[model samples]
Target: MLQSIQIMALPLQDLKARIDQELDENPALEVLEDRETISLDSMPEKNSEVESYFENSSDPGFSSSYDQAAADSKQSFMENALSKPESLREHLIWQLRLQPIPEEFFQIGELLIRNLDENGFHLEDPELLVSQDQHPAMKEMISIIQRFDPPGCCSADYIESLKIQASLVVDVPEAIYPLIEKHLQALDRGKYRDIARAEKIPEEEVLHCLEILKSLTPFPGREYSSAEPTYVIPDVAVTRENGEFRIMVNEEEIPVLGLNSFFDQVFQESGNNDQPGHAEAKSFVTSKIRDARWFINSIQQRHDTLKKVALAIVEYQRDFFIHGPKSIVPLTLKNVAEDIGVHEATVSRLTRGKYMQTDFGIFELKYFFTNAVTGTRKGGGSYGKEAVKAIMKEILEAEADRHLSDQKISDLLEKRGIKIARRTVAKYRKELDISSSYNR
Candidate 1:
């Protein structure tokens, strides 16, 4: 290949910096400051008439004083809420100290507990814990630890947990114990009649025993652990205005950047050749102005891209915005990219960690895309999986009188021209945390 001198396009990083500099010098572009929380319900009746929703109030006294108080309280609350909880190992050791056991046995239990998962299940077998000296009695010591509260805490498997629970039963129902020991799958599938016939007991008795089984805690360690709830901060806020959906970006959640005109004027006036330190003044002004401008443009670009992407999402998932999540149809990255005239990667980046607000609730920008269930009459009609789930939820909610089976749901979808298999309906239903017909 012949070597040749060639000029290629500027790197995105360099372009970004250049854009930032231009934005700094330009007065039209402004970076908004971090805004205070605004109550959507309390917004003025005519939002369009308001020049800028982002403009700050001129009430300086109330602004500074109230802001200080709010900041302090928020900091205190965050500190209190964010403290780390004790780990699973520490919890196990605490519990162990309260129990009476031989020193060597306690040591074994400690080792076993250390290897346990957060669910308190023994991940390794007790046989592996036995050293040459402890080999003989190690099995018995392991058995004793297995008998802890949350019956299955130290068990190797869920079957062992159920077995431990069964062992604790005072009056063993004739075949209930054995049936539980062997046919857990059959019970799970709601084959109570088969189990009852095999065990020679009434189906009601089998169900009652199953009820007892259901009461047992499969994971006892949950009480000792803390689970953090995710808080979704909406990027766009949708409101009902004149019986129509009006969308607005939640400006209160993000900071705004704007130029300080006083500083800019000072720099400009000081940078004249006649000034004592004109060069230094020019350099400093040039640098600061460049930085300020870049910051402002980056913020604006972020807002513009976010708004465009969100608006496109709104247009695509209009049914969902009007109705709810269930109305959300299966959509794809390509669709949005094509509609917005951007690359799939651009769409991905825009949607990353971004959320939207709608009449139904706040959701991530990516949540709108779902795979369609092909061959379903309605399913083929541009409906996404989210829409399918929405329809399923609607049907279930309306049918308060009785539970709708997966097959029944499939048939209903078929009637609506949505072709879906029974299993697919079951899978989506389960994903939604809606249990089977019997359980429901």
Candidate 2:
């Protein structure tokens, strides 16, 4: 049980790493590479005389049970290996290689690529690349690099980036270039009426232009960011079939283990001999086999417990899976523990760093558990904090005409049956990294 608890606390990747380390340290433990079949029937039974020696000693329950199933061959080793992310510098260099630029300009392009920040904006002045005599050549090279795959990559600021991207579109309205160049602050503040009046265009046209602007990527270089991407392997998968939600444990990544047949044979053959040191050698082998068997069983037990806890979470948050995150109800570790017949600590340990892949998206197991926020009406059910946050985000997104203050947001939520205070709304807004009404 202690071993089960320890294994349960480890995430799937960490558990795989632990098993790899154990395989390196323990000679008795070996991976069964062939997946065609696994049968322990060929394993010899313990000799009657050897059984008498272990009968007197306390049994650690390792010899009682063994895994005989084969691992699923669908998950290959190469699939789990990490793939490095391409950086912005590499992407620009690749694009430069494809062009028919002269050899001398290639050095200038490489220098420009190296000076770009993570946002794809140049860090230094382009004029600094060469003397005044070669200023025209430097400007020409900069123009070429800016027109690479990610349209706005080599610009100095967001305004320049948007202008560069605007130039690439075939039928962009004549007013868009001026709107982005002159009235960026007004546009950010959602002052569409001001822009319409300034450009002498209709309000509807301003809205249409804004929609076109929205389609442009603000940070093009982020697509090929240099930072390493985190890879998550789901521990459980929830799928909807025939209007029913089904939960399945993801055991493909985990390897199926069995006792080494070679070690078993050696122990069996040596048990019958009466050499001076045969008994000590046999005892040592028995201890190693017992340890390996216990490790294998503990892994199986962890798998079973993880599945049970995951199923309980699915049952409790059924509405969330069917609808969406906004439909998530108030839940806690205690709720899942009670449903699955385990202690709260055990449930918590099993869920740590565990992720579940559903039709909606991949979410950590803890995302389903949320604190309850009381409802405004007396008989109404409490709301999950996550649900309240989702509603808040929607409200903010739709408030393009006028930003709603915290007090206004609280009153709106109260009308919807949520009993959140103004201060609480402000706190949640801050956590969402949303600015106040004035800033918006």
Backbone clash count for every predicted candidate, in the order shown: 21, 0
Q: Name the Cα RMSD for model 2.
A: 14.4
lDDT tens digits by residue: candidate 2, 1-440? 67777888999899888888878877788887633345689778768676666665587543423343322232343444445566889989999888787887887788888889988998898778667886776778789988897889988988888888888888888888888889878877889999999899998888777878888887888888768669999999999999887888887777777778877887779856998988888888888788789889889888888889878888888888888887888999998899888899998888889999998899999988999998878798898998899888888888856779999999889998997889999999998899989777
What local lDDT score does residue 280 receive in model 1, on the 0 to 100 scale? 76
In terms of lDDT, model 1 sits at: 0.70
Off by over 4 Å in 1: 1-92, 127-130, 135-141, 174-177, 196-205, 257-296, 326-331, 371-382
TM-score of 1: 0.68
Model 2 segments more than 4 A misplaced = 1-6, 10-25, 31-102, 114-119, 122-140, 163-185, 192-216, 222-234, 237-248, 265-291, 311-327, 334-346, 356-363, 387-416, 421-440
